[model samples]
Target chain A: MTFDWQYIVDALPHYKTALWLTVKLATIGIILAIIVGMVCSIIQYFKVKVLSQIVQVYLEVARNTPLLIQLFFLYYGLPKIGITLSGELCGIIGLTFLGGSYMAEAFRAGMEAVTKSQIETGKAIGLSNLQLMRYVIIPQAFSYSVPGFGANCIFLLKETSVFSGIAILELTNTTKNLMGIFYKTNEALLMLVIGYLIILLPLTLFLTWLERRVRHAEFGN
Target chain B: MLNSGISVLFEGVNMQRLLLGLLVTLRVALIAVVISIVMGILIGIIRTSKNKLVQIPFRLYLELFRIIPILVWLFVIYYVIPANFDLNLSAEVVALIVFSLWGTAEMSDIVRGSIISLPKHQAESSKALGLSVAQMYRYVLIPQATKRSIPPMINLITRMIKTTALLTMIGVVEVIKVGQQIIEVNNLDHPTISFWIYGFVFLLYFVICFPLSRFSRRLERKWAT
Candidate 1:
């Protein structure tokens, strides 16, 4: 078989729209994940004993299980319990919870990396725990943790495709629909691959740049 | 109705199907792990190579693989490649190829990081002992790197196994797919069986993954001490 340039051209317009959906899903999902992750990390850091253990278990279950099952649980299971959300909302919620768990771990690792002496010095200056964390601990931790956070963000961006299974009309779902519609399986799937790369490549590059900047800042040179 | 669900799980024929599905999952994961480890080691070496050109491409390849979701890659490989190239491969083959590509990229990064994190003096001292590059790597460098690499490598293996669930989308009858089939069969009369069937699938994955998870942590502790 030979490459069909005409097929690719014909599919390009459809792929453009799918690429937009993919970008929207990833961007919104990641922003939500970062916010949820920060909140969960803060709670995990400061909450009392039993609450901490509950948060820890939540993180473990979220991380250990497959995202597909979790998506199914939210999209299909929640309605059974008298709580219903749109498929898109369910997808975003699932991605946020899953992504947040990993991001929380990254934040925790970052917090742990803050030197004891530095925290002690902040306290010696008569800073309360909250002030010490807000002023001294968190800023330093964020710089050191940027690479891990960036990596998790990129992972979340890709993982948003799992939303396709729940009929979210994202890139993968669109590709599958187009394939069934046109029966031009090859062209449709090729456009899907291109669609994913179009969205992911730039984000990957940006994250790499961000990681480098953070590393440079951390090392002071 | 509940009895039938339990019997479907334990009936000789159905039990065989579940066991066969389990074996297929294990087989795919085991083969993928072996292939990935070998490719990972080679790419890891290339990534840390003194040659700038080689290192740059390897780095790009690693990042691309890591950034692309496994499900998307599975779709691209199992559906796109065969259709694009007109190569008629089985779904299992496609799944293996895609998973190995992804796993190798991850493992290579892990290997590269662990190797680089080693003290520079270790390599320098080996060179001072008049060892050739090949001897230095073979005798001095790799043994230490292998120990450092085991925990992450095991974690990667568990990940690959869990990831096999995605193969069901491409029509490979793994355990999750088997569960879906059971649900479909019982849907007409007992729609609630969907939960039990899927719940069983979850337990199956947990059984397979939890041990590997424990083993990974154990190896991590052992290596640390």
Candidate 2:
């Protein structure tokens, strides 16, 4: 029952792949969420009829539901409809859809934070709505959202661990597999905790720094 | 809109089975929330304290809980504790511990935020009125903080309820786990049954969570104005 390093040493290589897969899942998932978020927020911002209502419903359903159920629905339920996806693929998609909803809220807040005065001035200067959005509104709105984007990315990283529930062999899954073989559940889990801590601790720190830097740059501090 | 799933709930499945699973989830979440609020308030008070030693441990706790996903926490609590310490705990008990631990950390943050956001003069006036520190907190501070805290607290409720779904991963036989079991037992290699059963699970969660979330949002908007 004592903590043993031997099991971890023996299992390190497999764990590395799991860690990499976790990273890849989170990276691709956040990227897709950002894309989804930007599009949805833009549509909602313009008060686009019908589409805005759809966006509202999508955001609410996603925000309310647990991500594990969403993953199960995609992983287990979707195949019922004649579509089969690998666990990793389904997990990444689930994370993308879940994180996309939160990311949309952030972007919407950022866009609304752009004062009416700024838009009016842009319009007053003979800028077309298209030119204004491209040159002024979107850039400023994005800068306002850098902090939100950072938070959303960190959240997406955490959410990717849910992939293990669907058997994606991520860090937690790798640990469980090692435990199955080595019968060193505690040691294996300690190593897994450390692995995630190592990855996430520095990430939280870096996001904090990045947020500060973004805020300073925005305020010209 | 989701009534279609309700028929699947009772059509080929034991209604009591799903309800029992759902009861387990609700029982765990309810107990965990009560524990969290109590522990959270105490920790929140310490978090605002002047002593560094008092604050550092809670700070570490918060940071650790923030990164470690609930699924990992559930696994570690359910499996790691028993294996390491030679203590046997049931699934529901372990789930309760993990959820309460995580919830306390989060709720404390909420408490700290609400209290800190109060005007400096409010606390000052309480002190100037000859109120002791306890009185200042109990009579003057908690009321205002509670009002400001309602929105975030509601958000945490929805989060706590949703997190109970992760209990399925650890084999808790909670609602989602029950849904999975039903799908497996009923379908017998027919995937389409899962479409209805899992769809019901989704709608069940949506029904429980949507109203709370909208209420939280409304509170947020109301307070913002």
Candidate 3:
């Protein structure tokens, strides 16, 4: 079969709109995930027994299952329970919860990597537990957490594509719609692949650069 | 309503359907894991090659796979590749190919990391003893890297399995799809089956993934000690 460059050229405008939507969802979802993840990680770290256990269970369920199910559960399952959110809202919420669970793990791992001696040193200087955490523990923990957190964010960005299943009109949804309209599955998909590469490559590079900068600063001479 | 939902989970046909779904889930995961391992080793080796031509292509391949989402890749293969290439492959075949490509990038990174993490002196000693490069890797370097890689690889396998749920979106008839179909059919009579069916699906995935998570931790501890 002959190749058609014009089809892809014509599809650029549609892909651009989808790309904007994908980036918006991913950014909003990631911001929400970071806030929720920080809260969950702090709850676990303090070890408030019952609440921590509840948080643990929630995280496990979210982490182990697929995001597709979680999205469907919210989109379709919730309407039965008298809770109706739009498909886009459901997609964002689903991604946030899933991303938050993984981010909590990242936060916990970072917090654990902070040496006890550092906290003790803070205490020796008469800093209270809250003061120490606010000033010493959290700062160091966040630095150590950056690499893993960045990786998780990249993963989350990629995962937002699944939102298309519920008809969220993101990048993947746009490609699917175009394919349906034009019946040029190949050209539409090819454009989608290129669109994703354009968006993701710079993000990945930035995260990698941030990771390297953090490592260097942490171990500076 | 809650009690009725609970009973449907235990009923015969629903149970049978869930079990079959679980089996297919495991099969897809197992096949993907095997494919990833083989591809990982090959790409990992190619990545470390001294040849600039070989290394550049392999590095580009890894980046492309890593940056793109698996779902997008799945869609490309399922809807785009066949039509583009004029090939008429089955959905399952497409899923496998897409997963393998994604897994290969991840596995290669793991392989490269573990191999480099080994003590430099070990390789130096092997070379000093006249071991060829291939022999050094085959007999000396690989065994240690494989052990280090296994735990993360197992974790990645669980990820691959959970991700198979995305195949349902493409009409793959996998476990999650089966649950969706059941919910659609039972919408009128068993309105609450949706929650229980998905809850059951969640539990099934947990049962499969939790052991791998535990095993990875245990291996990590053992290796550390």
Overall lDDT per candidate, in order of appearance: 0.78, 0.85, 0.84
Candidate 1 lDDT over A59-158, as tens digits, reads 7666666777677666664554456789888888888888888888788888878888888899899999889989988888888788888888777877
Kindly list the per-residue Cα lDDT of model 2 for residues B42-94, writing each as its tens digit. 88877888688988899899988998877788888888788768899999899
- Estimate the TM-score for candidate 2: 0.95
Candidate 2 chain A: 10-residue stretch with minimal lDDT: A212-221
Give the DockQ (2 decimals) of all models: 0.36, 0.68, 0.63
Point out where model 1 deviates above 4 Å. A1-10, A78-83, A216-221, B1-16, B84-86
Candidate 3 C-alpha lDDT tens digits along A49-100: 8989999888888888889888877887777667889988998899899999
Give the per-residue lDDT of model 3 (tens digit) for B54-146.
Answer: 878878888778887888777777766675577998888888888888888889988988888889998999999999999999999999988
Stretches of candidate 2 exceeding 4 Å from the true structure: A219-221, B1-8
Q: What TM-score does model 1 achieve against the real structure? A: 0.90
Model 3 CA deviation exceeding 4 Å by range: A1-10, A219-221, B10-12
Candidate 2's DockQ is: 0.68
Which candidate has the highest lDDT of all?
A: 2
lDDT of 2 by residue, A1-221 (tens): 67677767877888888888988889999999999999999988888999999999999899988898898889887787778999988988899889999999889888888888889988999999789889878888888998899888878888877777787999988887787887888877888888788788888899888877777655322
Instruction: Estimate the lDDT of model 3.
Output: 0.84
- Whichever of 1 and 2 has more DockQ, that candidate is 2
Enumerate residue pairs that collide in model 1: none
